[model samples]
Target: MENISFQTAEVGDALQGSNPAHLYPDIFNQGSIHTYDAAMDQAKQMVLKFLNSQKKPFSGITPNKLAEQFKKIDFDNPLKEYEALFKEVDELYVQHATAFHLPQYIAHLNCPIVIPALAAEVLVSAINSSQDTYDQSAGGTLMERQLINWTAKQIGFSEEADGVFTGGGSQSNLMGLLLARDHFALHKYGHNIKYDGNPLVAHRFRVFVSDKAHFSNQKNASLLGLGEQGVIKVATDERFRMSVDALKDAIQAELELGNIPIAIVATAGTTDFGNIDPIENIAEIAERFGLWLHIDAAYGCGLLLTDKHKHLLNGLERAHSVTIDYHKSFFQPISSSAFIVRHKSLLEIIKHHADYLNPEEQDYEEYPAQINKSITQSTRRFDALKLWFTLRLMGRHKLGGYMDAIIETSKQTAGLIDSDPDFELLGDSDISILVFRYAPTHFSHDTLCDLNQYIKKQLFHAGEVLVASTKVNGKFYLKFTIFNPLTTMNDIRFMLNAIKTYGAGYLQ
Candidate 1:
C-alpha cells in the first residue's frame, strides 16, 4: 500500500489558520478543538436539512441513474470543505435513503426511531465505547448490565438470568444456538464443542423451529458447522404459529430416527406473519424432552412492556435463551439487541481468558467482563445506551403506548384488507404486521401473482410507498410491518388504495 502524507502546516496556513488548526476539519482529523466544533456544527445542519426536507419514502431513482450520479464523485480526491462534502452526501445518499419514519413505509422490521435514542446516538458516537471488556467501557458495561437486568426482570426471568448486548437478533440467535449446542454436547457426551470442534455426536444433533421462524436458525446451524439440514422445519397452525403437536411429532420422529434433539426455537413474532408461537406449550414440550428452548422474539419483544398485549408472550420466561431486538419493536436504532440466558452460568461457554483483553483473574472481580458472555464480535458497540436513554427519557408506559398504537393500527389494517373485495387477508397478526395479497375477482392465480408483483415494483419505482412481498403456500402476499406509531388508519387506507390502483393498471 502506498501512503501519501500532506504537510499539515502549509495546508492549515493556506486555510487561513494563524493558531493551531486542522488541515482538514473532519471527524477523523481532530487536530484542533475548533475543527471538531466546526465539524459538529456542519453535521447538525446536515441532519436538520435531511430531516426537514420533505421527500417520499424512496427517491424513485433507478439503479443506473444512482450509479451515474455516484460516478461523478472521485473517491481518490478529497472534498476538504465540510459543507461541500455534506451537500454531495445529501444529494447522493440522503435523498435516496429509505424513510422509515414515513407512515407509508410498511416494508420490514425497521421502525421510526425515538428522539431520545437519536440523542443517545450522539453520545455513543462521540465516546465510541467498546463494551467488550470492563477496562474499555467501565460505565458503558455497567449501563449495559443494568439494562440487561431490567429487561430480564421484565421478561420474568429469575435472578440467575444475565445477558449481553449484541449486534442484532441474528447474532443473538446465533449465540443462543451456540450455547445450546455446547450445553447439549456437554450433557450428552461430556464433550466441549467449542474447543473440541464438532463432537462425535454432532451429526445427530437437530434443532426444531417453526416453518415461519426467521431464516437465522438455518444460518446459525451452518455457522456452527452443523449444516443447514440440522434445522427441522416444524409445521405451523392456520394462524402461522408453530404447532406444538407438529413439534411433538417432529421430536418423536427425530428420536425414532436415532437423532439427538438439541433445541426447540419458538418465535414470539415471526418475520412475515408476525405470529407468535405457543411458548407455554412449546416450553412444556422442551422440558419433557430435555431440549434447550430458545425464543426468537426479535420483533415482538416490545410486548413485554405493552399493557394490553404483554400476555402474548405468555411463556417467554421459560425459555433457556431469548433474542430481543430493541431496534425492531422498541423504536431504537439499528444494532440495539441482546441475547439473554436464564441461567447465567450457561454463558460461560463463550468465555475466553485473553490476557490482554479480559484476563481470567478478572473472574474474581465483582463485575466480570461483558465480552465473556458474548458469542460474536470481540469489539462490540455500546448499543445498550440507546435503550437506556430511551427508557430514561420516555419512560416505560410511553414506549409501550407506541407499541400499542402500532398493534392497533395493524388490526385496523387487517380489517381494511379483510373488508376490501380486491384483497385477501392471509392470517391473524399477533403483532403489528399484516400479510395480504391483492386479489381481483375472476382473476387467475398466476395473473393475480403477477399483478401483485407488478404493483409492488411500480410503487417502489414511483417512490409513493414501500411494502414487502412474501409467499404463503405458493401464493404471493404483500406485508405491512406497521411499527411507526404515527401511522394512522388514513395512511393504511391510502396504501391500500394505491395498491388497488396499481393492480387495476397492471391488469389493464
Candidate 2:
C-alpha cells in the first residue's frame, strides 16, 4: 500500500494549458512525433524494469489499505508528463500486480505469454484495428479467418467449418448454446429464434453437461432464456469424467419429464479438477438423440497442438461447435479465444447486416464481413494477431512441448501430494490442475476444512507463494493450477511446505 501515494489537486488546478491534445501523447501529430517516440521508449523501459524487478507473485497489500490509497486520487486532475504518469502507474498498479508468469504463482489457468504474442500486443494496441469488417481491418479480417480455419482443422473439422474470435470461453460457450438452441428450434418447431425470440418450446429446451462442466454453461443457459434448470448435470465417474451411462440416464430422465434435450456440452478441462468428460461417448449419445454436441475445450484445447496428449480429446471433431482459449494453454495474452463450428451455416442464426456495414444485399462471397457471423460484438479487437504471431514465431511443436512439460509436472506434483502424509488429494485432472488440501491424520473433516482455508489466506498474506481454493462436497480444498511450463517439482515442494507451515501455525 505504501508504494502508491498521490497528491490531490483542486478542480481549479486542473487542465494546465489550452489545446490539451498537444499536452497528451498522440501518435498522429507530425510535430509531436518526437514526444511519441520518447513516450514509447519510456513505456518499454518501464515494462522491462517491472519484469526484471518482480521477485514474488503478489505484493500482499490488504484490500482496505489499497482502497484508502485509491481514495486519495482525483480523476479531474491529469498528469501531463509521461514520466509522472508512469511513476504513478507503477506505484498504483505494477508493483501490486499479480506476477502470473512466476513459477510460484501456480494458482490459475493464466499461461505465461510468449514473447511473440507480446510483440503482437504492442502492434495491436498501436494499430487499434477493429475486426468487424474488411473496411475497418482488411488484413486482420483475413488473418482472423485463417486462424479460425486452422483451429477448426486442428479439431478435425472439415473445410466447411468456421468461427469467430471472442473475449473468452464464456462468450464462446454462449455462442455454442445460442446456435444449438436456434438450430434445434428451427429444425423441430420451424421457428426462427432470432425473429421470434426463444420459441414456445424454449421452456422444454434442456442442455446436458457433466457435473464438472464449466459454470458458464448454466449462466449461458439463463442468457438464452433457458433457466439454470435447463442445464442437466450428468454425474461423473471416479476420475471425474462424465459417465456415459449417467449422461444417457439424465437425458432419458429429461425426456421422461417432457423436457427437450437440445444439446450436450462436454468439458475438455474443468477448472477445479482439469477433468475432461468422455467426449467420444458423449458425442455418440448426442448423435443418437439428434442433439447438438458442443465441446467446451477452453482449457483443454491446447492438447490439439500436442501430439502426445491430443488423443485425450478423441471426439472433438464430432462436436457441432468447440471453444478454444489460446491464452490458457497456447501462452498468448488474455482474451485470445475462439468459438468454432463444424458447419459455417450454423452461425447464420445470429447474423445481422446493416447497409452501412455488412450490407444484406451485397455478395458476401466477394466481401466477407465478420459481423455477418458474430453476435453482440460489432467492434472487435484484433486478438487473432496474437495467436498468429505465436504460431508463426514460436511454431506449434515448441508451444505444444510446453503443454507436455506442464502435464508431466502436474502429474508429478499430484503424486508428490498423494504420497505425502500431511495432505489429502481429492480429485485428478487431465491437464494440470490439482485439487487437494492440508490435512493431518487426526484432524476432523470440519476442522481440516477450516485449517485449509486459513492456510490459503495465510499463503496469500505471506506473498511468497500463491495457490487457488475450491470446495468439493462442501469441504474446502486448495487447488493448484499448474499451467506454466516453468513450474517444477521444486516450486511445488516449496508451495506445499508453505501450506504445511501455515496449517501447523493455524493449529498451534
Candidate 3:
C-alpha cells in the first residue's frame, strides 16, 4: 500500500492567503480554506462581542440607517474589510444591542425559540430546499406532507386533510382568506377566480371579524382586492371574545346593505389579551349565512397539542380553513406557519398553470401537478422540517406539558399582580400573556397608564429585563408574554418588583 501524505495549515498564514489544498482539502481543495476559517472565526467573535455590548435586545436601528449600513458594506471584497469593519461594529452596533438570553427578557410576543429548531434552521438554510414541489424537494417535500398530515390530525381534522407551509401567521391568514374568497366566489360566480382575478361580480365581497381579531385578516382582505372597507369589524364582549349576537347583527346588516358576506374570520389568541374568540358560535353563524369560515389561531394554535386546553378551540374543526404559527406558541423559530383547509380541493381556488414552471406533461395518471394549488411565493422554504423535527424530538406530549407549565406560570403572575397593591390586572390571561398596569396608591387610571408607560421605557433602556406594553379600554398596561421556558415564577416576581421599584415615583 502507498503511504498517505498530509499537510498542516496555519490560521494566520491562511488569513494572509495560503495554498488551496493546505487550507481546506475537504471542501475547497482547489480553493483556499484559511481565508474562510479566518473569516468565520472573526465573524463569530465580532457577533459575540457585539451581543455582549448591547443594552437592549436589538440595536433599535431605523430602516434608513440599516439600509445605509447595508449599502456601506463591501460585499465583493469583504474579507479584509470585514476584519477591520467588525472591530468598529464591536465598538458601535454590538455594544448597544439587548441580549435576549438573559432571564429578564419577558417582553413582547416573541419567545426564545428552541435550540433544536435553531440548529434545524441552519441545516435547512445550508441545504436550501424549496418545498413547493416533490421534484425539487424530494425527501424534503415528503417531510412537509407528513408534517401537514400529522398537524391536521393533531387539530382534529380528518386524515384526508391538506395544507401548505407559509411564511408566518399573517401569510397563513392571507392564504386562508384567499381560499375562502375563491371558495365563496367560485360557488357563487362559477369557475376559479384566483388565477383570472375576481370577475367584478354584482355582489361586493366582504368578511366579518371581531374587533379583537388580528389586523392581518383585514390586511389580507385588502391584499386580495376586497379593500379594508370590505372587512366588517364585529363587536366583542367584556372578555374580548367575539359576541355571537353582534356577529349575526353584522352579517344581517351587510346583507341589508346589499353586500356579499363571503367569509367570517374568528380569532384564537388575540395579540393583546391572548383571547380565544367563540369559534363554535361564529361557525354556527357562518353555517346559517352559508359563508366560508376561517380561524386565525396564530398565537393560540398550540392548544391543539394538549387535550387539557384543546376545548378552548372547540369550534376550530368547523372552520373551512385555519391558520397556525409554530413560531408564536410552539417554541419554533420564526416563519414556521401553515394554512390548512378541511377539504383538499378547496385549495383549487389558487389553481392555475404556467407552462414554463409547471408543464402539462407533468400531469399524468401516475403523477399529477401540485403546483397550482398555492397562492404565496413559488419558492417556498422547507419550514415544515423544523416543525417536523421538533415534534419528533420532543413529542406532542412534552410540547403540551411545556405549554401547560408556561400557562400556569402566567396565571401565577396574574395572581401576583391582582394581589399586589401597586399593580392591577387588566384583562385575563388565556394562554401565557398577562396585561396589567401599575396602580400607584392614589393615582387615577390615566396616571397609572402614564406610570406604567414610563416604567416600560425605563426597563427597556436599562436592558436588565424586557416586557411588552399594550393599551386596553384606553389605558396603557404592561404585557407579560411567557413564552421563554427559562422564564420562571421568580423571574415574574423580579419583574413585578422592578416595576414597583421604578414606578413608585409616579405615585400621587
Candidate 4:
C-alpha cells in the first residue's frame, strides 16, 4: 500500500494502492488516526468561530432558502480534501445553527453547555462504545453506572435505588409511564405484563397529571396501550401548580366513573409557567390512594444541586420515580438525561436477558449490563460521560451556582415586567421560566394576541433576539426561559426592548 495522505486521499489513490483497507475509512481500526486529528482541529475551529462571532443566535434564514442550499449538494460525490468539506458544512450548518451560548438566547429550555462537558463529548464520540453490555463498553459502563448512582443520591434514593440514562426528557417520561403501566399490572393482579402484554382492562387504566404538565404524558399513555383519554388532566392553582384539592377530587371522580387510577405525574418544572406541581402534597395523596407517583423534573432537576433552591424540590425524594434532564438544567449537551426508580427491583419489570448479548447473570452486581434495564433501546451512547466529567471537574456546588444565577435573573426580569406598563406579567415560576406578554391596555384581547404573535415572528425573522411564545388560557403570551447563567439583566432588557420595538411597529 502506498502512503497516501488520508485528508487528501481520493478514489484514484485507492485504485493504485494494493491494500483494500484503503478503499474504506479505517477509522474503526485506528487506520485513520491522522485524519481524525485533522477533522477534530477543523471542528474545533468551526465551533470557536461560533463562540467568538458577534452574529445573532439565528441566521434569519428561511426554510425555503436553507432547503435550496441542501437541495443542490451532491452527497454521492466525494470531496478529496477535508478542508473543502468543512467549508461546505460551515456554510450550511454552523453559520445558521442556533447559538444557545449567546446571552440574547433567552428562549425555550435550551441551555448553554459547560466547557468540561464538551470535552467529555469528544471522548464519548471517539470511543464509540455501545453501553448495552460490559464487554462492549468496559470502563465506560462503570462510569455510566457511577453517574447513575450519583444521580440517585441526588434524588435522595436509598441504596436500593437504580436507573438508566436515556436520550432526554421524552424517553425518560416514556420509561416512567411504561413502568407505571407494567408495575400496576404485576402487583395489583399478579399479571406479568411483559409477556402477557397489556391487560384487557388497560382501557380503564388512567394516569393523572396537572393541566400544566408536559405534553409527553399523553403521548406516553398512547404508547403504553392507554389512549390519550386514559391520562387525566387535573386542575392547577393560580401559580400553575397542581391543585391538591383538585387532585383528590379527580381521583374520587375517576373511581366513581369506574376508571382505574394507575399513576400520578407531578411536574417539578412545567414548560410554560415553570411552576412546580405540589410534589409533597401530591405524593401524600398518591400514597393514600396507592397510586404510583412519578416526578417529571426534567427542567427542574438542577434544583437538587442548589442549596438555596433545593428546598423547592423537597418531595422528590418520596416519589416512586423521577425524570432528570442534565441537558436542560445541568448545562450539559443534548441527549443527557436519566429515568430513576426508588427501588432497584422495579427495573426488573423492563429487564430482558439475551444469551448472546447480556446473558442472565445470577449475581448482577458482579456482571451488570445496562441493556437489561433499558426499554425501547438496545444500543445506547455513552452520554453519561458528559455528566460524569462535569461532576469530577466543576463539582456540584459550582454547577448549582449556575442554576441559582439563572433563577435570580428570572426573578428580577419578572419584576421588571411587572413594573412596565406596556408588558403584562402573567405569573411567577418556581424556577427561572417566566410567561408574560407585550399587552398594552388599550388593545383588545384578540388584538393583543395578534400583536404578541407578530412580535415573536418579527424578532425571529430579524434574528436580533430570540424569545419563546406560548398561549395561556387561549391568549398569546411571550415566554422567557432564562437557562443561561451568563445571561445578565442587560440581555433580558435587550430581548424585552426588541419585543417592545416590534410590538410598537406592529401597531403602526
Best of the two (2, 3) by lDDT: 2
Instruction: Give the alpha carbon lDDT tens digit for every residue of 232-279 in model 1.
Output: 999999999999899999999999999889999999999998989999
Model 4 TM-score (2 dp): 0.95
TM accuracy, model 2: 0.94
lDDT of each: 0.88, 0.89, 0.77, 0.89
Candidate 2 lDDT score relative to the true structure: 0.89
Q: In candidate 2, what are the lDDT values of residues 89-155, reduced to their tens digit?
A: 8988988899998999988888888899988998898788999999899899999999999999989
Q: Write the per-residue lDDT of candidate 3 for residues 71-92, one digit (tens) a residue.
A: 6556686544666777757544
Which stretches of candidate 4 lie above 4 Å from their native place? 1-28
Report clash pairs, candidate 3: 50-94, 53-95, 54-95, 54-96, 54-97, 56-98, 57-98, 107-467
* RMSD values, in order shown: 5.7, 8.5, 6.3, 5.2
Model 4, span 1-508: residue lDDT tens: 8985554466546644755545666455456777778788998988888778846889888999899888778878978888998899988988888888888887889999999999989988988899988888989889988988888898899988999999989889999899989999999999898999988999999899999899999999998889999999999999989999999999999999998999999999999988888888999999999999999999999998899999889889999899999999998999899999999998988888877887775566787789988997888899999999899999999988998898899899999999999999988888988988898887777799889899999889898798898887898889998888888898888888888889889978
